[model samples]
Target: MFACQVEVVVLTCEPLTMGEERYYAAEIVLKSDFVNGRVGLQVSLEDLDEWERCLDALEAEAGAEWPTGGRSAWLAVVPEDPVEVTVHDSPSTQIAVRMPIDVASDWLEENRLRLDRVQKAVATVS
Candidate 1:
C-alpha cells in the first residue's frame, strides 16, 4: 500500500451569476512519502448542480472517470484500502483524507501544469 496524506487548506464560497447563486471553490494539497512530490488541486462550482458538473469535468480531465451523479459539498481522493475521514466542527471545517501513494502520483501527473503554475505564483508572492 502506498502511503499518502491529503489536506484541504481552504474551501470558499463565492457569489456568482449576478449574485443569484453561490459557488464553492477549494484548494487541496496532497503529499506522499513514497514519491518525492506534492500536488495541489483546485475546483470551482457555481452551485450544487454546477459543482456536480465541475466534478464530471474533473474526471474527464484526469482521464479516470467515476460513475457517480450527484453534488458533493466536499470530496477527497482516497486510497484503495480502508480509510477514514474525520471532520472537525470548527470555524473552518478540517477534513483529513488518506490515500495511497500511487493514487496521489496519478493525480499529481494529471494536474502537473496547473499545480506548477500555482506553486510558481505562490513563490512569487512569498
Candidate 2:
C-alpha cells in the first residue's frame, strides 16, 4: 500500500490528435516546488485511452449515485503500479508515485467547488 499527497495547483487539459484519433488528457502541476519552478506530471497519451475507458464505465452504469461515486470509479481505473514522473530537460531527475489517480481524484473531489483555477489556466495556456 503506497500513496503520496500532492497538491495539484493547475491542470492543463487539452485535446490531442493523432491521425484519426483524438484524445483528451491533462497535465497537472504539483505544488511541490523546486529552485526555479514546480514539478509537473503529464497524463501520458496512452493514458487518455484509460480515461475514456473510465468514462465509458461511468456511462455504462447510467450515472453514479453521488458525485464522489463517479470520482472513485475513475480512481479505481488506475493501474496498480508506480507511475513515472520526470522533470523536463533533466533526464536523470526521475521519480515515481503510486496511486496517482486516487490522489488526483481525491484532490478533485476536495476542490470540486473551485474549478475556476483549472479552467482559467487551461484557457490561458490554450
The per-model lDDT (C-alpha) reads 0.34, 0.35
- Candidate 1 lands at a TM-score of 0.24
Output the worst ten-in-a-row residue range by lDDT, candidate 2.
64-73
Off by over 4 Å in 2: 1-6, 33-93, 97-126
lDDT of 2 by residue, 20-75 (tens): 65444544344443322333333434443344444455434422211122221122
Q: Which stretches of candidate 1 lie over 4 Å from their true place?
A: 1-18, 34-79, 82-126
RMSD of each: 15.2, 10.8
Identify the candidate with maximal TM-score.
Answer: 2
**lDDT per residue as tens, model 1, 23-74:** 2233333344422322222233323334344345544543222112333323
Worst lDDT window (10 residues) for model 1?
A: 82-91
Relative to the true structure, candidate 2 reaches a TM of 0.30
Clashing pairs in 2: none
TM-score of each: 0.24, 0.30
